[model samples]
Structures are given as structure tokens and as C-alpha cells.
Target chain A: MSGSDASATTLGEASERETLKRIFPRLPESRSTIVGPGDDAAVLAAPDGRYVVTTDMMVHGPDFRWAWSAPYDLGWKAAATNLSDVAAMGAVPTALVVAIAAPASTPVSDLEELADGLRDGCAALAPGCGVVGGDLSVSDTFTIAVTAFGDLEGRAPVLRSGARVGDVVAVSGMLGAAATGLRLLFSEAVDAAGEPDRARFERVLAAHPETVTAQLRPRPPIADGPLAAQAGATAMLDLSDGLALDARRVAEASGVGIDLDPGLLGDDVEIALTGGEDHGLFAAFPAGAGLPGGFRAIGVVVPGAGVLVGGRPFDERGGWDPYIGWDGHGG
Target chain B: MSGSDASATTLGEASERETLKRIFPRLPESRSTIVGPGDDAAVLAAPDGRYVVTTDMMVHGPDFRWAWSAPYDLGWKAAATNLSDVAAMGAVPTALVVAIAAPASTPVSDLEELADGLRDGCAALAPGCGVVGGDLSVSDTFTIAVTAFGDLEGRAPVLRSGARVGDVVAVSGMLGAAATGLRLLFSEAVDAAGEPDRARFERVLAAHPETVTAQLRPRPPIADGPLAAQAGATAMLDLSDGLALDARRVAEASGVGIDLDPGLLGDDVEIALTGGEDHGLFAAFPAGAGLPGGFRAIGVVVPGAGVLVGGRPFDERGGWDPYIGWDGHGG
Candidate 1:
């Protein structure tokens, strides 16, 4: 079936072309999208002679709960997580291509709203970015898998293994904000709401919404990444799986140790150390270099073989393992 | 848990790092992977100053059947589908990034086998291409979403919207093989096998394996796409959704109509016109432009609205409609 073949009453079973017409105009148009959605593939400008590519997928039941998140929030989070990886690479995200798997029973309006959120997320957070292409399919479960391509603007990518000993460690944005938001969403006050969904969602948002928003719609320090890279940061990565675990990753990759000072993170010290999904940029730079405005010192890179918090060994690896349920079901 | 923090007893519940360690070696490495899997994002060389990117996903039930397709075939098909899109755009595939979501209960060996399949697929089908990066997540249903990045080598993309009315329509490979393969897989003889799965698969393979292979792991005319583009093809697309329907797409996009000659399709005229998943390169060239070696004229672009079969308007829309189900399960 074609786009023009659909009638007003036949919107529920609209052809893929028809559905795409509704989505195309809503997506932001960016200069990087040399060939946008509608073709077999999209041609995007690489600009600096290289492409920084990353992908992340969110599945229903595990990645989001419809009882809490709207379709729009899911779309925003999907774009946010992938874009943050590009940012962590010290590149400016240019375009996104999403492949969505859904059951045919899904409402057309829901998909449209999701596309709107995808466009809005890029515009409000990573300006000059847009969704370039997409593919749709029917499946038993709902899933949104997004791939983002970025341009480095002629600068070299900041890899996690580039850290050197004596480099001052810094993070752009709050650590563990998403972990705090997840905990809040599961609290008795939020889970025990007896009202209908709309009223409950509004009420939930009315209470400590900023933290909840961090979990549902993360606005990572995207622009700050390139600025830090330009300012001579040697190594970088996004705090997707908490500072402790991810910091250990960089330390291991760079063949060094890290001395983490949780106290420097203020009141959310523990969360800052162990919380995942923060999407903050963690980097290492020469000790005396001027820091980007969004960054604050978290610790220093050391010449050793382990991660030390407050100069002492830390045991808790409380970061999320996607395969393991909170109740230890799958694990 | 960190990469070195896992023990023999805890392998089943091993941390993400350990699981990734097993996956990393299984993925094929390429020179284009400036920064590979262990980084925040993979950096691939885009020497042409631009990149051609496309994505596709395969689900457990809808896209493949575990009983019919081995892990290797699934990997091959996933890679083939996305790479074909790059080929359709007249580009050489440089790298692939795969995101796999599967239940934690899945065996470690199975994941390794899947990764091996992915590597083998790249080595055998798309030489010089490799899996550069990936993300692993947990989900009840298994899904593999792959993104392929390509280098245009400074050539203009062959778009579906560029076909001219007088262009000759051509195809680079067989049509309807996958559709026929699907029919055979559903046959009673294959369904009634009492032998072990390995023996049964061999027996099935002994009976016209090429057709089944077409459905499971299509070897699309990848190199021929660029060849046709270089040979002055006016428009191009991969024969993914079938000839008649996809031809209609090109005609619609270019404001022309396609006149298909079913008799010229050799033996499987019906399949040639309607079979989905052929993955052949379909192109339109100037009336007398020298055709690529692999291409043969199958029709002609006409000056009209809808697709015509042998000079008559054809009503059957046999292309795959993703929203509709084979057994009416979803729509």
C-alpha cells in the first residue's frame, strides 16, 4: 500500500509509506542529513573525514515501563543515550537513524508523538542534530534501536584509553542523577498512586520532577565534550554504568589506577560513585589545564592497578548489569 | 563487575565487562576501526568526506525461526540486509555496529556462536568489512539491530527518485528464491523429519539448499550496485520488498510508471514480480547505456501513473507489508 492509498478511516492499518509521511515532516532537518529518510539508506556528511558511530537499543519491559513513561519520554531517552556516546567521543552528533519494532495494534498517534519527542530532544539539547532515517517492523515486543553518527570537526576522538598518570579527572554534569530518579520512581508514594494515569503522572511530575526527568529524559553535557576535547583532555567516556565501574574501565584500558573522591560530589556522594545512566562525560586532563564550565574535579589518575575511593578500596559494585534483575531473577 | 573481577563460579552471573571480553575477540577487526568496540563509540575512516549509513533489525519469531536458521545464518542475514542498503547507495561497506538484546538465560556459548556468525558473515560475504562496535542488553525476546556505514568514494548516490521515463529497468540477481524457500520450509516433508536437528538440517540442505539459503542468508548483489552506479544507472534500489512493488516506489518517486515483463523473469514470473527478500540490486539506466555485467533488462520506465504488467495495469500488491501478519496475528 502507498501513502496516497490510505483513507481517513484506514489510519489504523496505514501503509508504512503513509505512516512515514506523518513522521517525516515532524523530524528536524539538519545539514548533515544529505539524504534523509524515504530512501533505502541515508547519506550523511562526515565533515572531518571520519565518522563517530554508536548505537543503543531500548526494549519494552526492561528499558521502560509504560505505567510510568509515555511514548514521548521513551523516544527522548533513546536519542539521549546514543547521543551521549557521541558526545563522550568528543564529537558533535549530527544525525540519528532509528529502527522501531512494534505490534500493528500500536496507535498511529503514539508513533507520531515518539518522532516529535525525538526531534524535540535533538533540537533542545543537541542543536543542529536531526533524525535522518528509520525502518519500521512488526514484532511481539516494542523496541527502539537507534544509531547515531557524529562529526569530530577535524579534532581527534578522545578515547577511554588515552588517560595518563597525573591527569586531573573531571566530570561534566551531575553524577547519579538518573540513579536517584530511578529510585524515586519505585517509591511507595509514586507506585501507590490510586488515580488514573494522567492525574498520577502530573502529580508525580509535581514532586521532585528534575531528578525524575534525569532518568526519563537525560540532557547530557553534549557541547561541553568538544570544548573539553579542544581544551586538551586526554581521555573521555560517558558515565553510563556509574562512575566507579566506568572509571575502573578507563583505568584498566589506560593501564592505570584512579583515586576517586566521592566527597567531592557533595550530598549524592554514594550515588555519584555507584549510580548508572547518568550519561555525564568523565575525562582526564593535564592537572593544571583550565576546566570546562560544566566540569568539576572528581579525582586524579594514578599509577596503579585499581580504583581507589577516598584512597581506600571500595567493595560495592552497585552499578546496573542489564542482564540481572533487581530481584536477581535473570542472573 | 570489572573485566578482571569475575570468577569461574560466577561466570553465569558474570558482569557486562566479562561478557564483552568474550564478544570482542569473536568480532572481526578491520583497519577502518580507528577506535573499536571497547570505546564509547567506534571511529571509522570516512576518507570520502561523507558516509552512507543504513540500519535494519531482525527479531526472533517475525524475522527468523530458530528451528530454520542457525545463529550463523541470522548473523549473515542481518549483515546482508544492511550491507545491501549500502550497496544500493553505490558505496563500499566499511563497518557494522550491532546491538543485540537477549535474555540472560541464554548460554554464553550461544552468544559466542552468534558473534562468530557475525564475523564469518562479514569475512565471507562482505570482504574487508568488520563488526566494529556493539551494545548488549537483556530482553525477553531476541533481536539484533545492525547499522552499516559505507564510503561513497566521492561518487553520487543512486537514488530511487532519479529514474527517468525512458530508462531501462534491470536487475542484478535472481528473484523469488526466498519466497520459494519459505514455502519449502513450511512443507510437510521438512516438518515431519524425525532425525536430529543437525541431521535434519543437512537433509533439508541436500534438497535445493540454494533456495533455502536465499531465504536464510541472501547474498545480494552488493558489488554490482556500485558497478551499475558507475555504469550510469539513473536510479537504483535493492530488491528487498519485490520487483513490482519496489518498481512502483521508484516510478512514484520519479513521477513515472514501470512496465514489467514477467515472461522475461525466466521461470518464476510470479515470484519475480512479488517475492520479497530477494535482496537483488534493481536499477534504471538510460535507454542505451551500457549495462553492468551482472544486470539484465527486465522492464522499462513508462510515462504513466501505476505499475503496468506487460502493458496492463496490475492490481496485485504483493510486497511485504510489515504491519500485517502471515496468520493475521498482528493485523
Candidate 2:
């Protein structure tokens, strides 16, 4: 990301109070927020008797590189991913508490843009949800940990362990674009020595805006999550660790099996099946109950174990595990 | 701080799934948990219409060092600090979503102990409050970000902006011990070259268990928060920053000044006034209202704009701001 603002000052040059003054105004407040930032704790309304909560962390090197993502993209992606988890539980997002740690040398403008992205992301994906509280600190590596809260709105949470045999499995949102964009960034946006090059990344992003944007700032089908639940989704989860792996999770949790039709997946079925970071909703519904408007049927629950594609067992690792997959390289 | 488990394995040597399997059992569950870990999001009961929420982060170098703190201490401190924020709001802590990122070389056993600490801390400080969800990731530095949720139980939130000039200032839990412990750790528990020494840390800890333990694992009077609120506290805040700074915060927020009696502060009044990380409850109550059992009078709200000690303006730079205070040395 370019830090070209003439007034840019690194966090190290400013006190925490000064840095907060610069960024706080850009943050959005939710209707549910009774008390917003600047307090010891924020008070949020949860009209229902219950709330849904989840947390996710994105680390600098293992999650994204500055060479490939801007501060805005980082903030938006962080919000999107965690909001998806809340939505996956068939809840409407209400508030977020974000904690960020970055190197002292990071430019203050970058943090402002990050706050803007967090504001805009909540505005776009979950209209009534916004940042309620946050903490900022210094670290050698930049990291964001967002804890998202959602209101159940008097509805039962959709769980992955509710799928039953003879149910139809459907998915909402794009499947393989993010993973494909990641592949492209890794393969084409690097210099001769394999270090990510910002200039080349811009070119690649321009060449594949749809895919690259999906990877950088995903627009998951946030509304469709509650829609699926209202339509009586028996089992549901957000597609994060690839279709095959996530589908298998539902299968194992529900004590059933999933058999997907490859033909239902768009071209490059392999990528759609085993690629990750889709942030889409994958759900199961009663066979006759019709899929939600944004959902497309891709499989069916069967009385067996594991996942299958075209009636055959499908297992191709199916996802990325940072602990085992990271190659110890930022790029 | 010892990684003495013979069966210890580095995060990089195990898959995320295997590591979670070891940790899930150690995490505590709250009675309000409708759905705990293993789901897209945990569903927690928020019986009241509103919930108090807060987040805090601890970074490896700036917030802690392995040479001085164990994984257990890190986890305990992380939970204690965040939980204190919830309590400060006059709410009962209900759940926490913790996200952690550590070096690939960190031992799995250390993480297990960290989990135990999280479980035990919640069990000890705020009974029935427990870890409901969390995220694990890889980073060059060990970082922990915890977001705590609390139920107000129908009481109006006691805000920092609610104090009046005639209110009496009171406090629960010890002040300055944690900061004093930090000073001792830095000065006495370091090698000749100024790097933290594990042996020296152990020796210093043995020599001054009260202060050292206070720094590593604070036991803030969590219950006294709601007790003070029920006793008609007009305002309250947790003392994370020093007494003077935090008192100034409450004073500015409430448009009043705080006059503290130095005689009430124990010996070493300077440290008691300026040292940070106390995590005690500082509150304001009506002048004639009886103080809660655990709380004792320390000051009075005055008709001014800052903090006063012994009836005079107190302006020593009280408190630590990581951005300015961190000297780029882990020790």
C-alpha cells in the first residue's frame, strides 16, 4: 500500500491518545451501540435473549502481505470474514470489538484508511452493525483480531450438526474466485527472486479485478445467511476451508455424508471443490423446501460418512492450514 | 516460563486441528453458552436487553516477555485485563472470545497451559464466565486479543461520564502493586546486559511474591463492580493506567476534578499515584451513600478539570502508553 499522504506520520511519532484522535472519527457506530468507543466498555443492545459471537485473527505474513493488500483491504477482509461467521449462525450482526497491533513505524494514514474500511465494510455487508469498541497496541508484526457479535432475533441458531439424510445441500456466493486470485497473486505478482512486488501486484489486480477483489475484499452473501435459516436450513456453515472440507465438516457433525454434483459447479470444478477462503454460506434444507433465492443446489445429504463428488469419494487436502502450510515466507 | 513437558511439540510440527484437539478440553464453558466452541459462532445467552463488551490486546515485546512471564501468566493477564473492563461497566462477565497468534516454534504444551490459565482465571475472578470461542494463527510475535461480553442484568450502565462534583471517590483492589512488580522485574530480574534472565526472574519472584504475582497475574475485585453499582455509584472505571491518569480520565469525562488524599494511599505514594496496570475499580458514589464492603474511600469529586493529590494539581506523567513507553527492548 502506498503511504503517500503528505501529513502521514508513523505511529511511533505520535502518542496513543493522538493516534486515537486521528482514527476514531472515521469509525462508524451501530444503532445497537448504547455506548461506543472512548468508554471502558461499549454497551450494545441485544433485543433477543441471546447473542452470537465469534473471533478471528489475521496476521501479517501468514494471512496477507503489505505488498499484496492495502490497509483498507486488510480491514475490510477482517470484518468480512468474521461477519460471515456470525451470519453462518443465522444471526444478524450487531457489533464488533476490534483489537489491532502493528509495528510502530506503520503510518497513521494507513490506520485511518483501515478504520474507514472497517466502517464501510460494516455499512455494506451488515447495515446495522458497526465498531463498538477497539484496542490499539504496538507489535513487531501487524495483526487484527475482530470479535463480531450478532443478534439471533428470536430465531434458533443454524448449526452444522443439524443436517439430516435426504436434505439438499446448497451454497450462496462465489466459490473459487478468492482461491484463484490468491494463486494468481502468488504466481504472477512476484519479482525475479519471488518477493512480492507492489508494482506487479497492481498490474495483476487490474488484469483480474473480479478475482483479485474477491481475494482482497470479499463481498460474501451476508443477507442470504438469515434467509437460509428462515427457509429452515437444517445445517449451515460458512465456506472457509474449501467446499469439500467444509461440506465434510457438516457431514461429520450431522452424522451423514454429502455428495456434490460437479456439473453444478461452474467451470474449473477442481478449484471450486478444494480452494478456500470463499466466505460463502453452505447450508442444508429439507428436500422439498426449495433453496433460498441466492442459493444454488450443489449436493445432497446421504446416510453415510465423508464427502463425494459425482458419487465418488473426494479428498484433496481441500484447505490451507497455516501451521502446516506456511512456507516461512511473507510473500 | 519453563517448556518442560517431554511431549511438547512446536506449532509448526502439528496441524491446527491436532492443536485444537488438545486445547478444547482445557477451555471452560459458561452456563449461558447455547453453543460453545466447534461452531461457526458461539451462541451466548444475554438475558438482559443490553450487553457490555470490551476488547484488549497484549503483544509479545511491548506487553510481555517470555523471560519474565509464562504462557499461563500471559493467558491469565489477558483474561483479567479484558474482564476488568466488563466489570467496570457494572455488568457480570458472561463470555470471552480470545484470539491468539504465536511463533511457529512455540510449544503446544505451552498453549495448553495458556488454555488452563484462561479457564482458571475466569473460574476464579468471575465465576460462571468462560471462554466460548477463539481463533488461532501464526505470527512472528506472540499476541493475545480477548473480547469480553457481560450482562448488565437490567442495571443502567455506570459510565465514566456520570460522576458529579459532590460524589465521593472510592476504590477496590490493590493499587501500584503490579507496576511496582514490573519495576522490580526490569531492575532486579535482568542480566548485566539488561536482558531479562529467567533465573533472576525466578529469584526475584521468590523474593517478592506478592508484587511479582500481582504483575504476572492480577486478581482484581471483579464482584465489587456490580456491588458498587448496586450501592448507587455515579461513575466508575478500571485503573489500567495509573491512578492520576485514570482519575483524570473520569474527571474529564464527568466534567469534574478528582482530589485524592495521599494519606489514604499506602507508602510509596508516588508509585501509587503514577504506576500503571493496577486493574482496580475506581468509582464515584453519592456523598452519603455507604461504600460497598470491598471498597474504601480514596478521594472526592471536585469542581475542576483534572486530578488533584493532597488538594493540589497532580501532573506527573502517570501511566504507560505502549507507543511511547516501549523502549524497543523485550526486557
Candidate 3:
């Protein structure tokens, strides 16, 4: 790239229209878009007479660090996380409207890469799903807020309150990998003084690609969400805040209890039980109903009020909570 | 409220769930909400088989100042701005998904008041439209990102590119009050050092309630949007970035020129022509079609490429461009 190109130019030096002109070409238009970006709002087809919507925010420091996450990774993770929520509702994501607020000194190229990542993430995870519209603003802190829309295709939404006692508890997608990746970044990817070092971070990522990738750019089982719902999932939710805490939420919402089998979760049972940000689908199905192809039975619903591990109560809330969990560390 | 209540507690001192518990009661449920908050995603009805979607971001610095606006005003303006975009598309807003990222030190009661503002903004401007879902996170910059969904009720969306050479230009709602209010804020509602002063802002606001309220908590004519479309408006857009710049946008999009009659605008024609953030509906109607009730004719469309005032080409682009206009001052 030349000195005047996007890589060298900061957003502060560019007009909002000029920046948008650069981004519009990289973004993919959704199949359902009647009128895409550039207008006041994008018009999208809601073929089933109803749509599922979800919004999520990822802010610097509490959500991710510039030392660890690339602009592309941030965009991909934003798309993946919101798409997972739509899937948890048994809906196919149709469109996304993303609003990014970054420091004016941010490179215009960074936003271009983010747009590419959003396009690629949608194309890979949910074909035909694309970014239909978005907004940009200057802020002191970088924040990405995404609202995803999903098509239910005439199916009734599978809610978290539907799980019944005697239903088999199951999950799709890796559970412990993302949390393990975060631990690796914090422990092995930092310098001697506990700051993130690019060299050390790259070394750790190279050594544990799967676990680290799970943290940086997760590929949730988006398709399996609708499949589980189609197969009569009684209740479902995205396992964003660790299996233990999220399962307890389902139990509490459903007026039932869940009993998990540690042996079913991989070799690192503790990590699988308490780790979060996997964005996997956790669901309940009738005992006789066959579980979906990607899902494996990990537990059973029981008559009670909370979660259980081998018939004993597991009450420790081991999941991410921004206010309580973030240590005020940027890197 | 007691100190132990939301008034004194900061977000960092409360869990995400605890904060949500306090906010949920203050929010109103949309009439079309199939599933509201607490679910992984919200389900909303799209009775017209299509939806108009838009997203807008307001960061603390370029958008508002703490000295001038309360949390309630921020929330109300956020809703009003996004709702106006939906209305400009000739659609009735059905739902809103708001994402707020604020500093951890922000008091919880500020957020509760913000939620009340969102509720009331919806109730007063567009009845039956409510906050269907939202996300919250911790950030150094207070940012509000809102995604609005609107139902067309089967009418074709009025696009900015639909204007013809002979159309009459019209506007609904106050023109220069918001920008005039902002000018007053910048010039008089600040201390000698050019910093916003709370007491000075309140004094200025009390002296000019209509103008200051136009800036702090805009009440855009949301109902006029659908009415214009029903009455045969050719092109429409929300007058967000001043009459001159936004009209130029419509003119350029439509391959025509708009000529405004300064006599029709109120006194202070420069402010009326160049002021922004009123979020009013600006539209073009056939000369033969009777203008909508709230709308008043202000100009005429002519064959050309930009905006004009009294047959003279108005070349200066006067509008709020965060990147180019903000002086990097938060307050």
C-alpha cells in the first residue's frame, strides 16, 4: 500500500463518506436485502412473518485487548457470537447491522479488514447471511455493537423456559477450548511484567492453534441450532457463560434441575464445566428423541431447582461477568 | 432513593444480572414482541412480510456532553434519531434493540433513568413501539448503539433517489431549533475556558426551553413519515445533518437540484438552512399531490445536481461529520 492508502491513513483524516465508500464494496449484501446500505435504513425480507433479533456489545478492555485481537478477529467474533444467539433460538441468521465506534486515530485499513471479516464470517458460517447496514462513530474507546436478524421459517421459537424434567441435556460445539485459550494468552503470551508481547502471543497461538483460535475467532455450530430445534429441542441457549452457569440458568428458567456427567465432557472436565465464550448450543430433548448429529449427550434434566454434578449441587458461578470478572487490564 | 439503591451504586459494584433486573422493569415491551428480553434473542412480528432496519451510534464526545445532557436525554435522543430513520422510510417502527457501553464508574440509577427515557420516547413518539431487546457492557466511552426495526405495512419504501425535477420540497417539524440550541450551548452554556458548565447549561435551557429541548431531547415528527408515503411522496429522508447538506444528499441521489425559498423558512434563514439534528422528515411531493398535514412546502425541485437557495447554488456542505467536525473534546 502507498503512503496515502488505507493502511497509512487514519479515520480522523478521512471523511465519513470517504470511509464508507471504501467499506461498502467489501461488505456482502444479504440475500434478503431489498435495499442495502447507503439509504436511511436497509429493507430486508421477513419471509416467515416473524424474525428473531439479538444485540451484543464487545468493548475494549473488558471484551478484548488490542495486544491480542486483530481487527478481523474482532469482527469475526462479533458476527459469530450474535449468530450463535440466533441459532440458539432455532433460527437462521438473515442479516446483521453492525455499529463500530473507534478512536479517530484508528487506521482506515483496520475497518476494511473488519468488514471483510464480517463478510467472510457470514459466508462461512451462514451462507446468504450478510451485513445489510451499519454505523460508524468516533469514540475514545473502541466498541463493536451488532444486532443480528434471523428467519424462523414458520417454526415456533424454542425458548429457554421449555426444558422439562426427564429430557436429555446435550451440547454442540467445543466447550473448554475457548476458556483454555484465554488462560494460555494470560499466562504464556504475556511478557515478564505481565503485559502482552506480540512475539510471545504469536508463539502461544502457533503452539495451540485450536484452543487459541477458539478464543480469538470461534466457529460456533450455527447450523445445528436449527437442527436441534427441528428435532424437538424442549429448551435451548447459547453456552456463552460456561456450561455450569448456563445450564443452571436453563434449569432455573425451566423449573427443573440438571445433572451433568463429568466423564462426558473432555479430559479437562473442570475447564469444560467452568470455561466460557465457546458460544455453543446447550439444549434439552425428550428422552426418546434422538439427538442431532453434532450434539452429544452430556447430562439429563432432573426435578429440582439448580444444576448437579453426579447428583451433588454445583453452585459456583464460573462464567464471564464483565463488571465482576474484568480486572481493569487492557492487555 | 436510598444510597444503597441504584442511585449510589456504580456498575462495577453490581453484577450484570443485578443491573439487568433493575433495568427490565423500566422498559416497555413492544406490542409485536413474540419473545422479549431474557431470551437468547427476541422474536418480533413482521406482519408486512418485510422490515426496515437501521443502526446509529452516539458516542459521548461527538454526540453529547455530560454537562449538557442527563442520561435520560441521551436515551431519548438515541430513540428519536433511530426512529426517525425508520419513519423516513415510510415505515412504522416496531421494535428497538439498544446496546449501551459505559464506564464502570457510572451509577446504576443513570442507566435506569436512561431506560425510562427509552420507554417514554417510544410511548410518546411511536406508540406500541418499544425496546424489544438490548445489551450492556463496560467501556471508557459512554456509547449508545441502537438498531431499529420498522414495519412497512405493505407500502413501498420512500427512497431518496425517487425525487423528480418537478417535485415540491417540504419539511415536517422544527428546522433550526436543534442547531441553534447547540450553538447556544457552545457559545453561552460554557465556562470562560470553553468547557461545558452544568449550571450555565441549565440556565440557558431554562431561558430557551423549546430550542434547548430540540437539541437535548428531540421530538421528531415520527408520524409524518408514513403519512407522506401514503400521500404520494417521491423521495424522503430524515433531516439529520442540516437542511443544506441533507437536501444536497437527496438532490445528488435523485439526479436533481433542490431550490429552497428562504422566505418560507423562519427568521435566521442561515441557521434554518444549515442547522442539523432535528431528525425531521424531509420529502419531495408531486406539485399536484396535496402536502401532508404536518408538512409545509419550503422549496421546489429543479433539473440539476445540488442544493440551491433562492436560485443561487449553495455549495458549502454544512452538516455534522463526526470525523471532520468534532474537535476531539468530550465535554
Instruction: Report the TM-score for the A-chain of model 1.
Output: 0.91
Steric clash pairs (candidate 2) = none
DockQ of each: 0.59, 0.87, 0.88
* A1-331: candidate 2 lDDT, tens digit per residue: 3345534788887788988899888887888988888888999888887889999999998899999999999989999999999999999988888899988888888999999899999899999888888999999889999999998888999999999999999999999999999999999999998888899999999999999999999999989989888999999999999999999999999999999999999999999998899999999999999788699999899888999999998877788788976766565
TM-score of chain B, candidates 1 onward in order:
0.90, 0.97, 0.97
lDDT of 3 by residue, A148-195 (tens): 999998898999999998999999999899999999999999989888
Candidate 3, clashing residue pairs? none
Arranged by DockQ with the best first, the candidates are 3, 2, 1
- Candidate 1 DockQ, CA atoms: 0.59
TM-score of chain A of each: 0.91, 0.97, 0.97
| Candidate lDDT values, in order | 0.82, 0.91, 0.92
lDDT of 3 by residue, B220-274 (tens): 9999999999999999999999999999999989999999999998998888988
Error of 3 at A111 (Å): 0.3
Per residue, candidate 1 scores C-alpha lDDT tens digits across B64-182 of 76767777788888988888999999888889999887766666556777878878877776788999888887766678999898878899999999888889999998899988887
Q: In angstroms, give how far residue A216 of model 3 lies from its true place.
A: 0.4
Question: Clash totals for all models, in order?
Answer: 0, 0, 0
